[model samples]
Target chain A: MRRRIPQLVCGLFGLVTFLCYFSSHPIARKIYLTVTLDYWQIIFAFTLIVGALSFVRVNLRAVERGEDRPYKIVSLIGVVLMPILALIWGIRGGSPFMWVFENIQVPMQATVFSLLAFFVASASYRGFRARSLQAAILLGAALLILISRSSIGDLIWDRIPEAAEWVRSNPAMSARRAILIGIGLGSLTTSVRVLVGIERTWLGGEK
Target chain B: MDVGTLVAGLLTLAILTFLYRDNPIYKMAESLLIGVAIGYVLVVTWTNSLMALLFTPLFSRGELWLIVPFALGFLMFGRLHRRTAILSRIPIGVLIGSGAGVAIPAMLEARTLRQLSATVGPVFADGTVDISMVVVLLGVLSTLIYFYFSREQVGWWGRTARLGTWFLMIFFGTTFGYTVMSRMSTFIGRMEFLLSDFLRIIS
Candidate 1:
C-alpha cells in the first residue's frame, strides 16, 4: 500500500504536468507554473537541508572515529561559522559573509580548478601516443587544435587556424548533434517510464 | 596590503600546494571549501527560496493552499528516520514526476527533432556544393548509425561505423584540446592574481 500510493501519485503528477504543457487552458497553465516555480523552490530548500544534515552526519562520524579528525573539525567549523556570520551581518555585497565568499571561496575554487591544467597536460602526454590509425588521427587533430588556438600556429602557417575552424564546425558539430539526439530520445523514454509507473527507483528501496 | 587579498592569496597557495603532494594544508583547505560551500548554500536557500517564496506568500498574501507544499516539504525530513522513510518517497515521487513531465517535450523538440531537421536540411549554398556541409551531413548520419547498438555492425554498416568512429575521435580530440586551453587560461588568471595583486610584482 505504501509503495503503490507513491507510485500512483508520481504517475498522476507526471501525467498532469505533461498535459499542462500542451493545454492552453488558464487553469492548467497556472497549475504548471505554480508547481514548477513555487513548489519546486520550496522542495529544493528542504532538499538542501537534507544534504547539509547528511554532510554533518558523515563528518561528525568521521571526527568521532578519530579519522582525519583535525580536517573534519575544520570543515564543521566552517559550516557552522559561515551561516552565523550571514545571519548576524546579513549577506549584502559589502558584508563579511560576502567578503569571505568573494575572497576565500572564489579564490579556493579557482585555484583548485586551475590545477586541472597540469593534470590535463600530464594525461595528454601519457594518452596521446600514436601507435595506430585512430590514435594518429586523434593526436594530429588535438595538436592542430591546440596549436591553432596559440600564437605558434600563426607563426608556423596562416592556414592552420582555418583548418582548425573547419574541423570544429563540420565533423565536431555533427557528432555533437548526433549525441544530443541520442540523449533526447533516452531522456524521453525514461520520462515515459517514470510517468507510467514502470520506473520506481526514485522511491528508494521497497518498503 | 588588504587583509582580504592576503587571505585569498594564502588560500590559493594552500590549494595549489596539492600539486606538489597531498598534505595537511591542502586537506585543511579542501575541508574549508566544502564547509563554506554548504554554509553559503544554506544561507541562500533559506533567505532566497524558503523565506521569499514559501514563508512570505503563506503569511503575507494568506495563501492557504501553500500549506500543501509546506507539508510535503516538511515530510521530506522523514528520510532521516527509518520507520517514517516511506513518507519521504511521496515528495520524491512528485519531484521526479513533475521534472520528467517538464523535460519530455522540451527534449524532443529542442534536441531530437531540431537536430534531425538541421542534419537533413540543405548541404550546400546557392549554386555551390559546400564541402563542409557534406562533411557535416555524412558525419551526422554515420555517427547516428554507429550509435545504433540493436543491430550487428557487419559489411557496409561496419565500414560506415568505422568512418563514424574517426569523426567521433576528431570531435573528442578537439574537445580535449579546448578543455586544456580553458584550464590553462584559468591557471594563467591565478598566476596573474598572485603576481600582480598578491606580490605587486607587475603593474
Candidate 2:
C-alpha cells in the first residue's frame, strides 16, 4: 500500500503537469503556474536542507570513527558556523555572511576552477597524439581552432581564421545538432518511463 | 592590507598548493569551500523560497491549498529516520514526475524539432549551391545514422558511420580547444588578482 500510493501520485502528477502545459483553460494555467513556480522552488529548497543534513551526518560518522579527525572537525565547524552567522547577522549585502562569501568562498572556487587550466594542458599533452586518421584529424582541428582564436594565426596566415570558422559553422554545428536530437529523444523516453511505474529506482531499494 | 583580501589571497594560495600534492592546507580549504557554499545556498533558499513562497502564503495570505506542497516538503525529512524512510518516496516521486513532465515537451521543441528544422534548409543559396549547407546536411544525416545502433555496422553502413565519426571529431576538437582557452583565461584572471589586487605588484 505504501509503495503503490506514491507510484499512483507520481503518475497522476506527471500526467497533470504534462497536460497542463498544453491546456490554456484558466484553471489549468493557474494550477500549472502555481506548481511550476512556487511549489517546485519550495521543494527544491527542502532538498537543499536534506543535502546539508546528509553531509553533516556523514562527516559526524567519519569524526566518530576518528578518520582524518582534524580536517573533518574543520569541515563540521564550517558547516555549522556559516548558517549561524547568516541567521544571526542576516545575509544583507554588507553583512558578515556576504563578506565571508565574497572574499573566502568566491576566491577559493575561482582558484579551484582555474587549476583546470593546468590539468587540461597536462591531459591534452598525454592524449592528443596523431596515431590514426581520426586522431590526426582531431589534432589538426584542435590546432586550427587554437591558432584561429589567437593573434598568432592572423600573423601567420590570413585564411586560417576563415577556415576555422567554416569548420565550426558546418561540420561541428551539424554534429552538435544531431547529438542534441538524440538527447531530446532520450529525455522524452526516460520521462515517460518515470511517468509509468517501470522506473522505480527512486523508491530506493525494497524498503 | 585589509583582512578580507589577505584571507582570500592565503586561501587561493592554499588551494593552488594542491597542484604540487594533496596536503592538510588544501584539504581544509576544500572542506571550507563546501561548507560556505552549502551555507550560502541555505540562506538564499530560506529567504527567497521558503519564507517568501511557502510560509508567507500559508500564514499571511491564509492559502490553505499550499498545505499540500508544504506537507510534501516536510515528508522529505522523513528519510533521516529508518522507519519513516519509505515516506520520503512520496516527495521524491512528485519531484521526479513534475520535473520530467516539465522537461519532456520543452526538450522536444528545443532539441529535436528545432534541430531537425534547422538541418533541412536551402542547399542552394541564390544561383549557386552552398558547399557549407551541403556539409551540414550530410553531417547531420550521417551522424544521426551513426547513432542508430539497431543495425550492424558492416560494409556500406560502416563507411557512413566512419564519415560521421570524422564530423564528431571536429566537433569534439573545437569544444576542447575552446574549453582550454576559457580555463587559461580564468587562470590568468586569478594570477592578476593575486599579483595586482593582493600584492600590488601591478596597477
The RMSD of every model to the true structure, in order and in angstroms, is 1.3, 1.5
Candidate 2 backbone collisions, by pair: none
Model 2 lDDT tens row, A1-207: 878888888888888999999999999999788878887888888888998899899989999999988887887777787889988998888899999999999999999989998998999999989999989888888889999988999999999999999999999999999999999999989888989878888777774
Model 2 ranges off by over 4 Å: none
Q: Write the per-residue lDDT of candidate 1 for residues A1-207, one digit (tens) a residue.
A: 999988887888888889999999999999999888888899889988988988999999999999999999989988998899998999999999999899989999999988999999998898879998878878888888999999999999999999999999889889898899999999999999998888878887767
Give lDDT for model 2: 0.89
For candidate 1, the per-residue lDDT at A162 reads: 98
Under CAPRI classification, how is model 2 graded? medium
Best by DockQ: 1
lDDT tens readout by residue for model 1, B89-165:
88888888898898899889999999989887665679888888788899988999999999899999988988888
Model 1, residue A127: what's the lDDT?
Answer: 81
TM-score of chain B of each: 0.95, 0.96
Compose the digit string of candidate 2's lDDT tens values, residues B7-101.
99999999999999999899999988987887778888888999999999899999999899899999989888889888888888888888788
